[model samples]
Target chain A: MLVNRVKELRAKYNLTQGELAKKIGVTRQTIVSLEKGSYTPSLLLAMNIAEVFNEPIEKIFIKREEEE
Target chain B: MRLYITVILRTLLYISLAIMVYDFVRIEQQFELLGRGYIDSFSVNVGNQVGQVFIVITIILVIMNVFQLFVMKRNKRAKVEDYILPEYDASDERSVEITGKAVRFAFVFILLYSFLILGSYMFVPNYFLDFVWYPMFTTASIPIIGLIVYLISFKIIYSR
Candidate 1:
């Protein structure tokens, strides 16, 4: 499974789900699903999210097995 | 949800179409039974009623579409028209995948339902004479049922 720190980073940046979604060109519900770990985003979306957070993709998204 | 409302409006549009079709078939059946080449007052009244319903639905859908277009033209990010979503939402990667799964589920349901509908004709050998609405309604119900099932599946998956 892919685990992401989207929620943590978004909180750190003080951005609402809708704001983050708009910056990343996605619907707010997609952000909600991503935070809940029920949806895995595509590479393009991951890149956009990384740009919005000003972080590398690896720092935001990681494989669960790798963490283990 | 806006998505659900759109789906409901679309379903109503479909129902209006089915009603119009039902009115047409009923008139045809009347002609067959009476062996006449003319339409009667009751049939015309039924046709007019169905026409009115069809026109109402068409107007609603058209108004929504035009409003969406106007919103897009005025402001690219005016979310007041958010309810005017595209046919399948496809708003993001997650929704695209979910919509795809819903379509697949609907496809499988339609395939099986088609066979069942065909098999039902075996039991009703005289459907033409006895149950005139059976074929008309069932044919129309295929897409209606598929849309309902798709909507249900999409909602369940989206909530998950």
Candidate 2:
């Protein structure tokens, strides 16, 4: 499974989902799906999100070995 | 505003197409009746309803296009023409991805539905004389059904 710290980092940065989405050049729904783990963002989107959070891509997104 | 306008234009376009098919069938049926000598003259309603509905749709479409054009022209934008054509969800990568999935689902549905529709012709071996409109309507129904399925699938996927 693909895991992300977008929600956590957004909270740390004091940014709403809409603000993060705007910074990442994606829709709010995309961010919602990303946080829910129901969608895997593309590389460009991942890079954009990482940029928004001021973190590396791997730090923001992780590959989990176990299923939920 | 763009999305709403696109949806309205698409609906009007589909309605106009279906109406055109119905009018064609109606005119042909009238000719058949004329050939059979059942009517001394064509009915006054032959093209009136179809024509009026078609004209009204045309007017609405023209008005919308003109309004969009006027607004965009005020901003000195040339992309106003893009608003005239119907398009899939393309606001972002996610929407485009969902649209792709929806289109694929619709394609599969169309293929199966078309096979069933064509197979249904076997049950109506003598359709031309008694049910001429049946074939026309059914044929026109293929794209309409596909579009509906696509829309529903898009809605479901997008919601998820």
Q: In DockQ terms, which candidate is top?
A: 1
Reference interface contacts recovered per candidate: 0.64, 0.36
Cα lDDT tens digits for candidate 1, A20-65 = 9988778898999999998999898899999999999999999886
Checking candidate 1 for backbone clashes, the offending pairs are none
DockQ of 1: 0.71
lDDT of 2 by residue, B18-119 (tens): 767777777777888889998777863545665576677677767766775565465432344333333455556787788779889989999999999999
Docking class for candidate 2: medium
For TM-score, the strongest prediction is 1
Where does candidate 1 stray beyond 4 Å? A66-68, B36-47, B62-86
Consecutive 10-residue window with the lowest summed lDDT within model 1 chain B:
B77-86
- What lDDT score goes with residue B142 in model 2? 79
Cα lDDT tens digits for candidate 1, B1-160: 7567766777777777777777778777787756764444344455476678778877877877776556555644334333244446445667777887987898899898988998999999888777877787788778877888888898899887
- Provide i-RMS per model in Å: 1.0, 0.7
| Candidate 2 regions with alpha-carbon error over 4 angstroms | A66-68, B1-12, B32-44, B47-49, B55-85
